[model samples]
Target: MTCSEPARTTTGRLPGGLVTTTRRIRRTLAAGPRVVIAAVVKALGYRLVRVQYHGTLGEADGAVPRGTTVFDDEVPAVANLDPALLGALREAAKDAANDGVEFFVNSGWRSPEYQNRLRREAVSRYGSEKEAARWVATPGTSPHVSGNAVDIGPSEAKAWLSEHGARYGLCQIYRNEPWHYELRPEAVEHGCPPMYPDPSHDPRMRQ
Candidate 1:
């Protein structure tokens, strides 16, 4: 179909193979600058859009890091975090190592099924949905399911991350869990937003 054809449809698929290009732009804008640039290229009528078309734009330019063993599981665990996040962690770990600190991953990139199981376990461990929500998130809503959250460990590492992680867009989002971190690249420019007090206070965890 021509650009003159109705661009709006329930599917949001534009004629030149721009499936959901409009929503893609919004998500791109929300995700970060690199993805936004990818969307901009598409918005400017470029049909050659590639790589950046994934919902999160594939680490600014398809630069996913090779998985490596670390602590509990490994890099790119069962679900695999965003490559950019993995990259940042690698660099941070190197710097941390130089300071005589060792970083370790307690959990990373859990499958949705795994997340739900954890939630159920949390309910069992914590005694109620309310208490469980204070720690674990529901399946679809958890950043771990989306490969966007990680739980790091070893007190020294958490301490170093607390002091230096914002430099790499990794931040402890929940005040209650210092080991839990997420990539918010904007943190590099805008300063790590603000903590949510706990998962109970995080709006995303309300599911």
Candidate 2:
């Protein structure tokens, strides 16, 4: 899932834990440049805030390490995907690799709890449920939670998929997120369906 941009307003107080963490970080960085210290503190605050917002996730929920490939059976993110869809992705990845392209799984199957956390974070970032709906789907409506969707990464990989994915039944599902893909077995013959502008425009999300 995409991380929300750091909140724009600077008026709110930091959480007590975050405040204490910041002081500790500042002391640890006493000899660092002013700019570097400030940046580090900000980054730490963002991470702690996310920890508070999303709790914690582990392998069972499909969290995977960086560079996880479609063929990695040991990774829950790759293993828990719908079998047919996973097969298509593996076939596509194998072909893509011949051309020096690698498919890295940025996200795959997610638990409902993780999906809900993401939706709530999106709402906090965008300031309303209406706006957040354009990006994050509700837990019950998210394809990721149902093992039917995958978000791939590395610009070259996404570009390669855009050009050749449909041949393997993998198709981009949203106009705004080229990284997001789903399996459409019919796409191998007739080509993929039209793209939704965003999650908000998808009929499946209304359910």
Candidate 3:
């Protein structure tokens, strides 16, 4: 389907928590005959298994150290990002490069496995899964796993980008995570939920 085509089928809740339009259910039925019966049954409100994030599978170990660098231990695969957003990020990076600001992609996409590993490690180190979940969003909840979010900043370029990033279609979601930005448009009317919401007034908003 084209990008302009509506991605979501359901407008309201289904019998279970599943939500989708009758048209989509029918289409799926017609396209995959073998699974048609099961699909129809699922359409009645059997929630589909939560999609596992597959983006972080190939990430190098210790790509991002535990230090306070802008990078995250896991990120979504860059290939999954919208083409337009990816182009915009590259352009933004190039612009920064021209200004003599060295920037790198500290984190991009993350797979479910990577997120789970981080979660496990956090619990092991911090002695609380709750603490781990707080610091790192549970797999599916992470924007980095969407491949549309990135953290960017130089040791000194933070201030400059803070003033100019929006021009490149990037916005900082959390004030505390000054290095993190995503390709969310100023005005988004359709498609999936934004990777990052505007930071809240709470000091712990980023975490």
- Candidate ranking under TM-score, highest first, comes to 2, 1, 3
lDDT-based ranking:
2, 1, 3
Backbone clash tally (model 2): 0
- Listing every candidate in turn, what is its Cα RMSD in Å to the true structure after a full C-alpha superposition? 16.5, 11.8, 17.6
Runs of candidate 3 with Cα error greater than 4 angstroms are 1-77, 187-207
Clashes of each: 0, 0, 10
Q: Rate the local accuracy (lDDT) of all candidates.
A: 0.73, 0.85, 0.56
Clashes of 1: 0
Which 10 successive residues of model 1 have the least lDDT summed? 55-64
TM-score of each: 0.63, 0.73, 0.51
Model 3: per-residue lDDT, tens digit, 1-207?
Answer: 012233355544455444334666767865665466556545544544433343544444223432322222243344455566667776766777687765566556666677667767878887886655545555666666656566665655666566566776676766557777676565233322233333333233345
lDDT tens per residue, model 2, 31-134: 65654545564655442133222457776787879889888899888898999999999999999999999999999998998888889999999999999999
